[model samples]
Target: MNLYVRSANGYRVASVDEVVSAAKRAINRKYRRGQAFTSPKVVEDYLRVKLSYEDNEKFVALWLDGRHRLIAYEELFQGTIDGTSVYPRVVVQKAIAHNAAAVIVAHPHPSGVAEPSAADENITRRLKQALELVDIRLLDHIVVGKQCVSLAARGLL
Candidate 1:
């Protein structure tokens, strides 16, 4: 059965089977269309269902190349209701390990506010700067909630 956590913003739906099915369906759709997806909302929707069982906040980063092709996606960290601990060194290392040319980062807000928090801004800035040293570019940092926000589009990164 699906479980849900009701918050002031909306319901946090949790069901591993449901999330996996959704993600597989999305992946299939993309494969069938022969297109690469760069939309943060689509990615976040897939991840939310995947991570619904975890009560804490979770962050996911998708590493891409210069051609805007996806290399890999990593769940950087998880934290309580307030925040998550992100290590710049680790993030940099992961980018290099994947040989990524660009990156798109995302995190879920349990409160359902897609706006980046002060800490989110700080972390994004730090990651961008760190990745730059390795010649990797940060394409976007997205905050996912009931909706989504893109830091790159907002000129925050």
Candidate 2:
């Protein structure tokens, strides 16, 4: 389906798929640096652009410095449509390796439901505790699908 998108110039008609693709690319290019990711929306927009179109599940980590600036973003794990195995050890290792003071971890649900599964909660707990040991804070665990659910907002973090 197509929709009308309001651009700075005016409204333009385009397919929903094309609009999403364009938005993703634009967001990536525009917010690569300068913007310190200050809200969950930033992470959500980024993951939506980068991973929302995927067929399989992907777990990505956005490593941040002490000021919450982006250190790096990495797809740490991948799996089939159902679920992916996320190891806290690996996540912590990467945080230490990158000297990340905080992290925002996110994954997409191919099923288009952003609700956290029981497994999602369990892993979030494990990752939080693991990162604590390394002095890196777990800012949030966002589940991205048709919508983005911030576990931190729900006090899941």
Candidate 3:
């Protein structure tokens, strides 16, 4: 489903999914002009808007090719309001399967606090290590809520 603007042509309402799809396309276009994934803020904005309406904890991975072109945005895990169990092995496997050169993983907090818990920190560390073994860089683990927290910026990764 997609939402259309009130244009001179017509009127239409798009579903949240459709809006997100459109947003993704626009964002990709902006970055693909020889700037792929160079701005962390852009990625965070995408994640924030993509997961904004989600009420549950949804773990998403943005898989990127060698040149940092976004290959896919995959929601790999879902859990309750508080937490989700993310398997480093499974994440690594998906990265390998996608032949991704790098990945940015994120999870939204339904409570709207973007703070990274100790578990979040630990998982980031583990995932960094896991991906390192395969030569796939774990670019960042973002905690999304009212805002996005980049563990990498915090030196957590």
The 10-residue segment with the lowest total lDDT in model 2:
27-36
Write the residue-wise lDDT of candidate 2 on 65-148 in tens digits: 888888788899999998999999999999999889999999999999999999999999999999999899999999889998
lDDT of 1 by residue, 19-103 (tens): 6666667764553322345565565555555443445788777777777676776788888986889998998998899888888
Q: Scored by Cα lDDT, where does model 1 land? A: 0.75
Candidate 3 similarity to native, TM-score? 0.80
Q: What is the lDDT of residue 105 in candidate 3?
A: 97
Scanning candidate 1 in windows of ten residues, the lowest lDDT window is: 28-37
lDDT of each: 0.75, 0.88, 0.86
RMSD of each: 7.4, 4.3, 4.1
The 10-residue segment of model 3 with minimum total lDDT is 27-36
Sort every candidate by TM-score, greatest first.
2, 3, 1
| lDDT of candidate 3 over 110-140, digit per residue (tens) | 9999999999999999999999999999989
Please identify model 2 stretches exceeding 4 Å from their true place.
1-21
Against the true structure, candidate 3 has what lDDT? 0.86
Error of 1 at 122 (Å): 0.8
Report clashes for each candidate as comma-separated counts: 0, 0, 2
